[model samples]
Structure formats: C-alpha cells, structure tokens
Target chain A: MTTTTAAPPGGRAARAAAPSARATGPSTSGRRRLAPWGFLAPAIVLFVLFLALPIGYALYLSFRTEKVSGLGLGSGSRTEVWAGLSNYAAALGDPEFLASVGRVALYGVIVVPTMLGLALLFALLLDSRRARARTFSRTSIFLPYAVPAVISSLLWGFLYLPGVSPFYDLFERFGWDVPSLFDGDLVMFAVANIAVWGGTGFNMIVIYTALKSVPSELYEAAELDGASQVAVALRIKIPIVTPSIIMTAVFSMIATLQVFAEPTTLRPLSNAISTTWTPLMKVYRDAFTRGDLYSAAATSVIIALATFVLSFGFLRLVQSRAFASEK
Target chain B: MRLTTGTRIAALAAATALLASACSGGGDDAGSDDGGSAAGPVELTFWTWTPNMEKVVDLWNSEHPDITVTVNKQDGGDPAITKLLTAIKAGSGAPDIMQAEYQKIPQLVSSDALADLAGSLGDDVAGQFTDGVWDAVTLGSDAVYAVPQDSGPMQFYYRADIFEKLGIDVPTTWDEYADAARKVHEADPKAYLGTFSANDAGWFSGITQQAGASWYGIDGDAWSVDIDSEATTKVAEYWGGLVEEGVIDNKPMYTPEWNAGLNDGTQVGWLSAIWAPGVLAGNAADTAGKWEMAPMPQWDADAPATGAWGGSATAVTSQSEHPEQAAEFITWLNTDPEAVQALVDETGIYPADVPASTEALTDPPEFFSNQPDFYEVAAQTAQTVQPFTYGPNINVAYSAYNDEFAKATKAKTADAFVDAVDAMQQITLDDLKNQGFNVSE
Candidate 1:
C-alpha cells in the first residue's frame, strides 16, 4: 500500500549499492581502512535518505498547518503557518481517528493469535516423523504468502458476496440463512480471515525453520523416556523455539497495527469500511482525500509511537517471563 | 543540535524539490514558446474517463494540425481529482488537461491547482452552457476554471413491466411514490421500488438538491453549510420512513446483490442520472426492454426540479504552459457541432453545452430503445436541474455521510436518518473551521 510513498525517499540512496558492497568485503589491512568505509557508505546513505529524511519531514509537517484566508481563492490565500502542537491535539481529539485505532486493535487481536496458532500447528504437524507428503503440504501452506495482500483480499471479497459466492448456494441447499460477510460486526472477521489466510504461510515457514534447527537428540531422549510424539513436541520442540515464536509474534503485531492493504482493497465491496477504518487508512485519507497533510503527518507520528511502545513492550514482557526459565 | 540539523536538512530538501520543479516549469516554458507559434508542433496530454473520448479527440487532432492531444484514461470523478491535487502539491506531473467535476471546482480553485481561463477563452464560451452549469466552474466569480462538458440531470428509471404487473400507476409526486413503493412491496415481498444507497454520497446529495436544498452557500467571503436544512431533512425522512417500513430496500446500488435484484425483477425502480443507460446495460442486460425512463417524482408537482450526480468538465492545470491552447481544444471539444456529435456518438455523454446536446442527442441510447422520446424527456429534465454551491470541505462531508448514513440505514429508522443529516452538517462545519476557512456561524 505504501510502496509508492516508500520508494521516493529511499530512491537515490538505494541505487546500485549492492555491487559496491559485495566488491569490497572487509579488506584486512591498515592501508585498506578506507575500503570498508566505501562499503559502509551505501548503507549509511540509505539510512539517512530513507529512514532519517522521511521521519524528519513528517515531524516538520506535523508542527505546521495551512492558514486559509477569506474565501481561500487564488494562490497564497492558503498559506503555511506555524501550528505548534495543534494538529496533534486535533488528531487525538477526533472521534473518527479514535474509532479507527480501536477497529485496528480489534482486527489485530483477531489476526495475530489465530495466525500464529495455525502456523505453529502446521509446523508441529510437518515436523512429526509420521507425517506424509511433507513437501507438498509445506509448499501448499506457504503458497499464500506468494500472493500479494491486495490480490488475496479481492479473491476473498468476491467469495464473501452472496450473489457470486459458492457458499451462498451451499447455505441455501442446507436451508440456512447466512448474510453477506460484509458490513456490521461481521466485516471485522471477514478482514481478519483474509489476513490469516495470506499471512499463515510465512509465519509457518519461520516456525518450521526454527523446528529444524532444534537438535534431534532432545526428541530421541524424550521418546526413550516413554513420552509420546505429542508429548515430545509439547515439551521439547516447543520450548526450544520460544525465541522464534516471540520474533514472529512481534512481527505479526507490527503488521497488524499497519494493516492497510486488505481493508483498503475490500472497501469498494462493502460500506462497512470507512475512509478511516484503520489508523494508516486515516492518514491516507487526511493527506490525500481531505488535503490536510499536517494532520496526516501528526497521525502518522502518533501511530509510529504507538507501534514502538506496543511491540517493544511486548518484547520486554516476553523476555522477562517466557525466557526466565531458559536463562 | 542534531535535531535542528534534521530540520535544516529537511527544509533544504523541500527547497531543492521546489527548485527542481521550477526548473522543469522553465523547460516547459521553452517548449511552449515554440507552441505559441503556428509553425511549431505542440503536444498536450489530457486525462479523462469518458468512454471512447479518444475518438472525439481524434477529430480534434485531424482538424488542428499543429496541436496533438493524447488522452490518458483515468478512473472517473473523485480518484481523478485526488490524483490531480496530489500532482499539484508535488509541483509537477499533472496533465495539461484534466477532467474536473462540478462539485470539486472550489477545492481546485482554492488549492490553486486549476488555471483560470478568463483571458484564454472566448466571450461566447459562457453563453454555451446554462447559467447554473457555468456558475459551477466559476464559483459565482468571473474566473472560468473549466469548460463544461457533460451534465447529469437525474431522472427516475423503473421497470415498466413490474409497474404494470402490480397494477400501479407511474408515480408523479413524492407522496404517490411512497404509496406505490408500499403497494409494490405488498404485491411481492421480494421486490422493492428502489434502494437507499448509503455508499453513494453523490446520489444522496443529488436527491437533497432536488428537494430545494443547497448544502453550501457563500455570502461575501464566508461559506455556510446547510446539510441539516429543512428540505434535506424532509427528503431524508421520506426515504428513511420507506426503509423503516420495509417497503424500500436498504441495499446499495452497483453491488452484486442489487444487480441480481435488477436481473430478477426484485428491484423495480432506480433513482439515477442521465448516464444510467450505460450502467444498466452493463449490470442487467436481460432487463433491456423492460426498463423505462421518467422525470424524478417531484417534491411539489406544480414546480418540477431535479439534481446532478456525475458529470465532468475539461480543465487546464496550472502547470500547463499552454492554457490558451488547452482552453481552445476544450472549447471546441465541448461546443463545436462536429466535435459534440462525435462526442455523443462515441462517449455516450449528455453534453452540458445546451445547443450542442440538443442538436446531437436526437435519438435515444440503445439500452432505452423502447422509449423513442427518451432524450426529449432528458432534455426537459436537464433544464429543471437546481443550482447548488459546493464548499472546499466537500470530501470531509461526503465521508461523514458514508459513515453516518451506513449506521442510519442499518438502524432503519426515520429519526436516525435525520440525525445522520445533522451529523454531516456538524462534521462539515467543524472541518471548515479547523482548516481555517472563514465560515459563518
């Protein structure tokens, strides 16, 4: 969703740095000290241009706003003025913005847990020696991540429509009444379903890699002690992959907060999704649709702060409790 | 010091961007200097969404040898306006010509995105369109922002077969329409007269306009919002009551269910605009001969009136080096008899240039071939379209309408509908004040 915005800031610095970095790999001499500097220059440039500049621009824009004079006709009638913290204050006070944040929080709560659980289950199943068609099952589970979010959302959106859905026919055949999976309370679940379908594969692969990296001796020792396969997985494999689970959980939490593509793509199919259905969506609408870039910038800054606090706080909590026994 | 340095670098980058745009503008100046002369060839890019607009532009290109117009097809209405405004802020990449909606003229003008064509166009250009249509581009001022192309004077479209089958008369007034809706629903529980589209803000705005409500009014230099005006509340209550009583469907238009309803003869009537034929043809091709067009049922039958939904004008962007040439092409494209004929034949639009539209739209569209006098009634309805002013904060109000009306439609109550209107008014007014626009209390 933000590929267009992300490209411009990072464009100049991210160009053709790979070849330069690869060519000058840590020449070990005092005389060749400048060689490593040449390699590091590209990454430094990218960080400054992509990360630092955009953040700075957003901060500057958040503190300033347009002052529309009488009628606001002609050029210079709408002039930029120092707004201080007014844009931030307005964003926090806006009911619509608050509603959007709350909705995304609900969406995150639905998506993250369900997605991680399915991913873990799939990983555990594939890791068992008794499992058959392992490669086929693994590929199929991981395939959805290859499809972009927007495309998957559209696919699910059509299936959710009663007039076009095969499920509609099945429901009628069963003599049951099921309304559209859009609008009202049902839309949140509909959006979360698409996210889980598209996201589970990637998370599954992460857990699978962590499972493979675990020593086989632990499972053997558990089995020799008369533990079942389920017992072995629950006790040995699960405990070993706690860090990977935490990593994936943190990533999913961040992605959940920044859920833009699925809801935006499904918007035309349902009136349930507002322009400010999510905080990122709210920023897009305010900046592009309402033509209020200052408020949009402020909202972005606030959302960024929230994402940092939430994800880092979760990491701190997990490290304290989940890793205390391991340490 | 480092934080201030970040601010300084950011400011420098912005200045560099502005300078880069200024340099590009200089380049276009050089290119357009040659364009000013008849001997030099000029190329112009136009962005529009009207179907088969390229054929109309081809006629212009053939007749005018020195100037070449390239049509870049875009998504209609709001998306196109959004892109244009984005380009305007970025200070580059806007097309030489743009398709501007009537409601967005003030926003564009205030943003300084559109070039006012007061000096570029001929005096006769103002006389080509109705005063109401002309005033839309000008914002009650003398500066012309765009050349009027098409006008959507809304009319009622109904299934004549369904009306006849139910033994109901074609409704002529708002009260009769409600009675007919109830009768139709009673005869067949699956069917409805029409649906109240919560998603379609323009559809609701047009209905409000038809009810003698102007949501925005400009006095002196201040803008006043009236979304909660008595006329609009009355209009909302009328639809809300029907929905609440389960006579009218609460489903939105342009949805798959609505399309299925149309195909199955469960949605009997549509309150839509002049371009309804194309949409009907696309959605429910099987219902071709069964449908018919009529004037929108009047609030007071003694004085008939209607409102606009979707129409756009040909505008020149401020970034365009050759506003005069762009204006000339637009004028000829909209008003020239040959160009208008080609436009009508190719794009299937109801031209806003009154004389050209009258001359070109002699025959009915293919989808409504059952009614030979379709354009005749359309021409008459076009004349009765009421004038409405648009403010800069229209986007804010439209989004609010979507959110509030969705809830109201779900609640299915007349009171909720009225409250939705109140919410829209408050949101729009607050937005204007927050954006620092001078708004009257």
Candidate 2:
C-alpha cells in the first residue's frame, strides 16, 4: 500500500478557528484561542491514542515479520525482521481475499440502496401530516437498533433454519415448500436483510432529524404554490436532507467494507458462509487463528485505505454538488 | 543494496521507538502490583474457556491459601489467542496460567509466549500422561511447555436399531463403511449413514489421523507437510463419493438442524470423539437408548486405529512472575486424582491422568443406554490414536478446509483430494515457509 498524504496541519487550525470564533465575547485572539484549545485537548489526545497510534503501529507491523530458523521449536529460533511489502503483495494476490472483497461489494450493492430507500420512506412518513401512530411506528422501527449485532444475527440465524423457523411451519401448512433461507443462493440476501433491519431505523432517525431542521417557511411557500405533500417532499425535503443522506451513505459504505460480526455469528447456522467469507474476517483469521499478524496487519491497512478513499472521494463529490446547488 | 539496508535500518529504528514508548508506559505497573501484597499471599491469575471453571479454581483456592488463584473465563480458540497476543504485545495483563489447545501450542511456542517448564516438570511428571498428549506439549525430547489435561479419542457412534433394521453389520473397514452408506441411504432416502460436516476441519484431521495420514511430522530439523498423501487422498475420495452420490449429508454439525436430524433418526450414524456423547445425549434426549459406540472404522480391520480430536492443556505464559508455582498447580491439576475427578465432574469428559481411572469412565452415564461403557471404550480408543503433532498454523489449514470444502465436496472425482491438498495442506506449507520455517513437502 502507498503512503496516504498526511492531513494538513492548517486544516486543523482552520477547524479550530471556524467554530464560534466571531460569536465569542473575547475579541482578543489569546483568550479565544485558550478556550478552544482547552475544549479540543481531550479530543485530540483521544484521537491520537485510540486512532493514530494503532494505525501507525499496524503500518509498522505490516512491513515486519518473524524469521524462524531450524525447527522453530522455541523463541530463540525466531527473530523479527523487515519484510517490506511482501505481506501486502500476498494479500492482494490471494484469491480468497479477492473473493471476499467481491462478496462484500455485492452485499453492499444489495444493502445500501435498499436500506437508505426504506429509511427515507420511513422518515417522510413520520414527517407527513396524514401519518398515524407516529410515536409507535417510530419506536418499533428503531427498536432493532438497540439489539447488538451478534445477538440480532443469532436470532435471525435460528429463524433461517427450517426446523425452528415459524415461516417453515407456515409454508408447510399452505402446502408450500419454502426454500431454506440459508441456501447458498439466498444466504447473502438473508444476511443483507438483517443489516437492513438493524440499520434503516438509525438512518431514518438521522434523515428525520434533518427534516425537522428545515425551515417551516419553505413548506408554507410550497403549499401556497399549490404543491402536494409528495411534491413538496420530493422537491424540498429530500434535497435539503441530501447532506445527511450522503453522510449516512458514506458511513454505511465504510461499515459494509468492514463487515465481520453478522456473518461470523451466522456461520454456525449455515455451511455456505466460509471462514474467510468477508475481508475483515479473513484479517481476523490471519491474525488470531493463523497467527500471521503481519499479513493481518497489511490486510487491515488495505481495508482502512480503501475505506478512506471511498468515503473521502464520495464526500468530496457530494459536497461540491451540494455547494454548487446552494450557490 | 544500499537503499535496502537504509530502509531496514529505518524500519528497525521506528520499531525500537515504538517499543520504547510502550515500555515506558507499562514498565512500572508490573512490579507495583506485587509490592504491597507480598506478605499475605502470592496471587496468580489463571484464564480458561471451559464453562463452570469456578468449581475447579475454587477447589485449588481452598487447598492452597498461600497462592490464591483468580479465574478468568475467556471465549476459547481464536478470541483467547487474540487476547493473549494483545497482552504479550502490550507487555502485561496476561494470566499466569492459561489453557492452550494442543493444536495451538506450536504457534504459541514459536511466538515465545509460553514459558519452558522442563526444569519444573521433570521426566517423572511427564511420564504420567499419554504419549500422544505428552508430545503435544513438548518440544523434541525436552522443553515441556504445558501439562496435558484432556483428550478426545475418535469413536464410532451409531444407532443400533437402525443398523439392525437394515440387517447390516457395523462396518469395520472404509470400504464396508462406504457400502453401508450406500445401502442405508438407498433403503431410506430420508436418512443417510452420517453427515460430512464441511465446517468441521478438526473432525477431518482426526479422520486423517485414524487413516494413518500424517500431514505434518518433524523430520530431523525440518517440518514435513504432506497433506495430499495417498492415505489422505484415499479418505477424501471415499467421503467425496459418498457426498457425490448424495448418500451422506453435507451439513455442518452442532447446529439445531443437525440436532433435529439426529433426534428424528434422519442421521443414523456419527463418527466423532469421546466428547460427543455428552452433546449428543443433550441434543437427542428422545433417542437416548438408541445410540451405541464402536472403534472408529479402519483402513485394515485386522489392525485397529483411531484419530485424536478436541483436547487442551494448561500452559504457563512467559509473562508469569511465578513460573515454578504455576507449574506446580498445572501438574497437580492434571495429575492429582481429586483434581481430575473435579474437572471430569464439571466438564463431563475424561481427563488424561495417570492410571486412567475416573468415575466418569468407570461408571457409564445413563445417556448412552447403559449398554456401551464409555470409559472402557474411550480408554481403549485413546490407546489406538496415532501420535501426531498438528504443526504451527494448523488453524490456518483448518480454516482453508472450511473455506474450500463446499467446492471440493461438489467435485465428484479425485479432484476433491486435489482441492483438499491445495487448501488444507499447501496453503499451510506456504504460510509456514513465509513465517520462516523449514518446510519439506
């Protein structure tokens, strides 16, 4: 992997300056600077320790490996040595790793658009004047987000089994032989359904909050222009919530690339999902199970780089378009 | 050449700086914890994955007031390894005694994470356990790393009622076993002789062991990896045909569906280790009296052999402050009759203690219809297990098997053996070579 261009120091300075600099009572640069620095110190320190240090260490470890001599029976036979980019090359060349990447790409294609579309629909319904039981529907929809991914996956894993699934009994009663949810062809959609169920509610809340932030005057002017609620929603509400939608999309894309827990938890229920079914799971298998930390570190670095490039490139494209439209 | 040297030097410098900073943060915390409490008792932290481990630790704690041992339960296998590795990398927070599976000992030993216990554990202590279990924890003739705790000797578990109904004798050879699979499935399309769990690599390894396929063996100074040997290929092709003809179910074991199948008589036979009886009895409570045990089928019925599966040992980490005391506890825990009994009562598996006499073995649990004596059968079976050491990165090989098994099972010809050889054996050889081991193919 190539070195990521270092984020600029001036960008931090600009961020530090842009937040409520003019609104502060102290017009003097020194007092205003002191307050922001004090507020930012804890976050900066945390960012360094939890994020930057680990990334740097992984980068360092990715390029180094242990060289063992003789039988490798003991510690004395092994010595840490520099391996350069061999681990990265191996990870890239590996068919299993490439297949996992391809699988996750397909999963993301199925999950993201479907999840965001449902989320947008829910948020619009909650905001609409004709909607009933707003609180009930909102709470019930968002309830799944409260369950941890492992627990949710395990719950769905059982429901996918024919022996235990109510759907199986229901289908059998109707003289319909329902295909197993864990069949190889349907397993991806089954996995994607769990993600969408757990994810859409949270995204809906984000878009709903953004919808609430829209000025009432815009809606009033749209009604004065004799526009229907659907027309107003399509033309005004969605366009205004574009930023939140883009943010959710980017976050989901990053998350989808690093999907590990759902498939791992669902593995015991199905034979179709392999140990290296996802790129992140392969990294996990390499590091812990295989005891090949160097390859794991390199693969993680590759995943991190991919996430950054995809998320940043997406944000940049969306931001430029959003800004252009506003102007 | 100059640029390469410069890069190496730079990388080394960066690594040193990283290590130095980490050391500075954690260097003082180690000696500080032991300072104030030295006069009272030497506290040792132990980690294990077995459920209801508190009883065993509590037994030890009550016996020895001088060294109070604290118990920490971790999820077994990969998670525990990850936690231990993290602790080692950070230079602290490792338990004094932790349980490492036999398959993982080589990997842990290569990392230098385990303490050499040869000095503390003499030949007398080492001689008590079974030879196969002993070799798993030892390096060459000396350098004992862990004490053997338990073993899983492969056994044949089948439904006697079903076999009687089919008028087929219990197959003692692979060829007869294949014939039995065909006859049983042909008789009832709803049932198969047994399942071939695509996800269970350990079971496959055990089968390979039973078939006398030594995938990894130490040859003088190098590790030999021959995963696609004639013996292994024979076993794979045998299973592949059964799977290809739809005589054997290709389902993952230990799932609810598998349990349902076993209980409902859709699965007539199971070939697994001694540890399976407990799980089978629990899952198939309705079919309690129907199951029975026999020696695992062999390549030659005249000379019987079996494979070894899921077993673990108590290993002392290199990070421990009191290695001698830790070794003492581990030895006592495995060798002492009372401790062995307690472990057996808690875990419901036979411990690999000297004399091999425990109530668990002597008294057959009522779950298996009281007809087949579990202890007598397993003890005899354990004796027949061919001693094999799972080489370093064995889990990687197992993961490869699980990853490629579906395709391999689909391929009807000898191509299945080729896939198994590539994924299970070749990948591991390449990985071990990359890790700088001398691998002979």
lDDT of 2 by residue, B124-145 (tens): 7877777778888985557898
Global lDDT scores for all candidate models: 0.86, 0.80
lDDT of 2 at A321: 70
The weakest ten consecutive residues by lDDT in model 1 chain B span B1-10
lDDT of candidate 2 over A1-327, digit per residue (tens): 133344566567888897667556656656666889889999999767655666677788889887888778766887779999998999999998999999999999999999999999999999998999999999998889888889899989888888768888799899997788776658889889999989998999999999999999999999999999999999999999998898888878877886778999988777788888898888777766776677877887788777778878988888887656667
TM-score per candidate, in order? 0.91, 0.87
Model 2 alpha-carbon drift over 4 Å, by segment: A1-36, A212-237, A319-321, B1-41, B57-63, B165-168, B358-360, B409-414
The structural similarity of chain B in model 2 to the true chain B, as TM-score, is 0.91
Q: Write the per-residue lDDT of candidate 1 for residues B8-39, one digit (tens) a residue.
A: 32333333333333444444444455466666
Mark the regions of model 1 whose C-alpha exceeds 4 Å error after superposition: A1-33, A321-327, B1-39
Go through the candidates in order and give the C-alpha RMSD of each one to the true structure.
8.8, 9.2
Please tell me the interface RMSD, in Å, for model 2: 10.5
